[model samples]
Every structure is written in structure tokens, then in C-alpha cells.
Target: MPAALEESAKPVIIGRSSSHFTRVTRIFAAELHVDYSFRVVRDLMSSNPEDYGGNPALKIPSLQTPRGVWFGSLNVCRELWRRSSPRPRVVWPEDHDEPLLANAQELVLQAMSTEVSLIMGKLGGTGDSAHHTKMRQSLINMMAWLEDNATSVLAALPQPRDLSYLEVTLFCLVSHLEFRDVLPTAPYPELNKFCQQFAARASIGETTFGFDT
Candidate 1:
């Protein structure tokens, strides 16, 4: 993308730099060649919907666009795709009709949400509660399942595609677990390998997760 055009079309992306969901949309924006201005949400616990770009759900990664406010990563990514002159071939969640592809997508998102809950609980000083303990165990179980199925799940994805939401989210989920120390990711070799490969992309490199200064 050229600098002049990028500046002219700069959409405002509201979210924390460290958020996996936010990173997903940022990656898509980069891939789609849609330059955006990032607005950092300093406090994750802020009750103001304005903090989340008019998202009533108060979630990060909401896109403030000329058309309107998009309230989720997927929606933001789709909108970005639509705005791109030459759209890349993208495989969305709805394209996963087979059980293997569909289940993998489901599990990846579930794990991401579960990680969010666990982290929120810890930050709220409820890390030692029984529910937290159960959530931890559930996370452990889900990781194990993902590790065991990683090979087959990835193999089942459509070939010759520019990108897939399944792969992007899986990469974010696995990498975020390691990044936040929600779990030790060393045991999931397949997922780790996948991340190693995916991390080489320019889109992924530009959006490396970190705290905003």
C-alpha cells in the first residue's frame, strides 16, 4: 500500500495492543492492505462503552469506520476485506462445513475465550477460587485436545487459500497462551510449530503482541 492512500483511508482501530482478538483484526488489516490508526484502550475494566469504540459489549477490537462501528474482530476483518480493491481469497468460519474443520474452529475460539476468562479472574484477584481452578483444569484439557488433534485439523483445511480465520485464530490462541503465561505452551509441539511458521508472515510480524507504552 502506498503511503498517501494509506493515510487517506486510515480507519480507527480501538483495542489493546496486547489483545489476541485485536491482533487478529490488525493482521487481517495488514494482509488486506488497509492501513488503520490504532486507539489504545488503557483500562480493560473500564465500564464506558466509548472505551470500546461504542461496543456495548465493552470488548476490544471494535473498528470505528466511516460506515459505522464494527464491534468484533471478525466483523472488522470482513469490512476490511470489503474495502480492499483486490480482495484476497479468505476462508471464513462458515466455509468449514466438514466436522474436522468446523470442530477445529470451534475449539480454537473456545480456548481463546477460556483464556480471557482465566486471565480476567486472575487480574481481579480471584485466581485461587474453585471456579478459577476448574477453569484452569478446563484449559489444560483443551490444550491437550488441541495438541492431539493439531496435525489432522490443520491437514483438513482447504488448500491454496490466501488465508483462513481458523489458522489465524489458532495461531493467536496458542501464541497468546505462551505470551500471557496462562499455560506453558512447550508441551503442544504441533501448535508451537504452527506458530513458528505463521509468525514469519509480515502481517503477523507487524502485529507482534505487546503492552502499549
Candidate 2:
């Protein structure tokens, strides 16, 4: 059995609450029944050595585990999966074309996230205009392809009710996109529907959307 959630025993999550990456980790932790305490590390836009120490890339969702510090949301999730009883497996199918499709999904989601971040910066009056235009074009192109292709990709994958890292990452991306109002929600109706369904789950409900401090 996993250790109980003692005050001092909780793993420290070295990131702010509002970060989608951090939320993904938190939600996974909740699912795995891994107790954690979140520490607010603000000023993500600044390049500070201390901030980089936790996650050399200065990314959010770095975990301070008993073993040591683990970086990256996905990496932390994997660790949590390992620690959890009845370990979770990747939800994508093995026999079909799921591996490639999953890779494409992740790539598009990453691009979409970057675009939304740029758009947020622009709206906040702290972004470069040229970069914003370029990112917006890229986002639009990626979204078009995602909308046109997601159904086929999903069709190839096995249907499992339990959430996987892929689903968690995808959920965070879609929620962040909506929260930032980067794209019209109606355009990606299928993705939006998936998000709505996923959001109703206890883990997701516990990790509501917000911008990190």
C-alpha cells in the first residue's frame, strides 16, 4: 500500500498551481493517491538560475521526490505511475497505427500550446508582433489538421475508459486553449466534446483551470 498523506510526507510539487503542466501532474498524483504539496514559483518569463535548478529548462511541474528532483510533467507522471498500485499503461493501441498517431497528437498539442502562450503574451502587451503572427499561423494550421484527423487517429486506438498520460496531456492542452480563448471552441467540436467529458471526472474536477502565480 502507498504511504498515507502525512503533512511532512507529501512530495513537494515545485511549481505554481495555474500551470497546465503542473495541473496535469497534480491530477495524476490525485489519481495515483500520491500526496503532494504545491509550492508557488512565480515569474516564469524571467530566466533565473534558481528557477532553472528545479527544472533545467525552467519548465513548470518539476517534482521534489524522495529519490530526488524529477523534471518535466510527463516524467513526473511516469514516476507517479510507477509508484501507484495497479500501474497505468499507455492507452494508445499497440497493434494498430497508434504509436505514430499518438506522436502526431503530442506534436500538434505542443505546437498549439506554444501558440496559445504567444497569444496570451500578445494580449498582455508583452509579445513580439512578428512572432505572434507566425505562431498564430502555425496554430491555425495545426488546429485544422487536428480537427480533420483526430477522429481517424482515435478510431485506430483501443477504447479504454481509464485516462492515460496521453489523455491527460491532451486534456490540459485543450483546456488551456479554451481558457486562453486562443481558438474558437466550436471549430474543434469533437475535441471540445472530449474535453467536456473528461473534465467531469473527479481528478480533473479537482484541478480546475487557472494561471499560475
Candidate 3:
């Protein structure tokens, strides 16, 4: 994490600063003390694949690295973990063998994806469309489920661990809802409390969501 070392031959992280998926990988990189140069993808609606670092899926978070392009936040985060010396103990999605843990991970990811669809729909001027309405309901259902189960989910996470993908993704999802103004989260007291506690991390502060410019 030395200043000189951080500036040396860093990988390029291609994504918009406001993306939740992008923030997820950035948080992981920070936690692992991995340095990388950020390349802003200025246009989210760009049809060209090159606009998103040659991602065929046109996703925001594609990591251009020495090894090759790693598409998606999960792959990028895994690669970041692999590159870190003295790697910290991380609880990945695969480690959630129990029903409670597995369900939490599933709901968190699903909710994130749903939130993205809703945002895109609104930006595309389809906010009043039937599918958009369904997506809103889906997000509502998922949030209600997560909020009601937050206490048990937090208590169930494995202790003495450096970090868990579930927790990080959950934090990003909740925080992004507020950041993007996609949903009003005031009703979810449990989730709000969790976010309040998690926001104390330096990584969280460093990766605060905002427009690139």
C-alpha cells in the first residue's frame, strides 16, 4: 500500500463511479490494498461494446488487467483478491452453505439486479410501463423480506472474518437505492441501522457513490 507501489503498473477498472457493481469491486480492492487506475465509462446507454471495455454484455464493471479483461464485479473482485499479498480471510458467496446464508446472498444479488433494471427503465423513459411496475413490486417484496430478516441475517454471518460478500453487496444495494433515488428506504429501520454501522469503514467512504464528473 505504499504510495510508490500503488502508482506502479496498476490495472484499469472500467466503470461509471455511480454504479453499485463498480463500487463493489472498488471496495474489495480497497480492503485488499490492491491499487488500480479507474477508467470512467462515460455513457451507460452506449450500444458499442468498447464503451464498456469490450464487454459483450455491455456491463459497467470490466477490469482490464495484465491477465486479460475480467468481466463483472464478482470476477473482478476475485481477481483482486488473488493479486493481493497476505490476503485477508474473505467469505465468498460459495461459503454460504446454510439456507439462511444462501438465501441472504440470493436476495441481495437479486435485489441489486432488480434495482438496476428499474433505474434503467426510468432512464429509458419506460417508468410507466407494465414491466417497470412489476420490477418495482419485486424490489419492494425483496426489500421487505430483507428488512424483516436483517436481525437474524446479521447475527448469522460467520464471526471473526475480515469480510463477507453478502454484507458488502447488501450495503451497496441499500446505499445505491438512496444514492440513485430509486426507492425510499426510511421504512426499513433494520437495514438502515446496518448501513449506518457499515458506513464507518474507510473503504465505504472512499467509494461513496456519485457521478464521475
On lDDT, the candidate that comes out on top is 3
Mind giving the per-residue lDDT tens digits that candidate 2 earns over 25-113?
88898888777777778776757746733566766668776677888777787777667777654553223355557665566557646
Per-residue lDDT tens digits for candidate 3, residues 85-150, read 889999999988799889988999999999999999988999999999999999999999999999
TM accuracy, model 3 = 0.94
Candidates 2 and 3: which is better by TM-score? Answer: 3
By the lDDT metric, which is better: model 1 or model 3? 3
lDDT agreement with native, every candidate: 0.89, 0.69, 0.91
Better of 1 and 2 by lDDT: 1
Could you give the candidate ranking by lDDT, starting with the highest? 3, 1, 2
For 54-165, candidate 1 gives per-residue lDDT tens digits of 8999888898866679999899989888888698899999999988789888888888888999999999999999999998898888889889999998888887789999
**What's the CA RMSD of model 1 in angstroms?**
3.2
Which residue runs does candidate 1 get wrong by more than 4 Å?
A: 1-8
Please count the clashing residue pairs in each candidate, in the order shown. Answer: 0, 1, 0
TM-scores for the candidates: 0.94, 0.81, 0.94
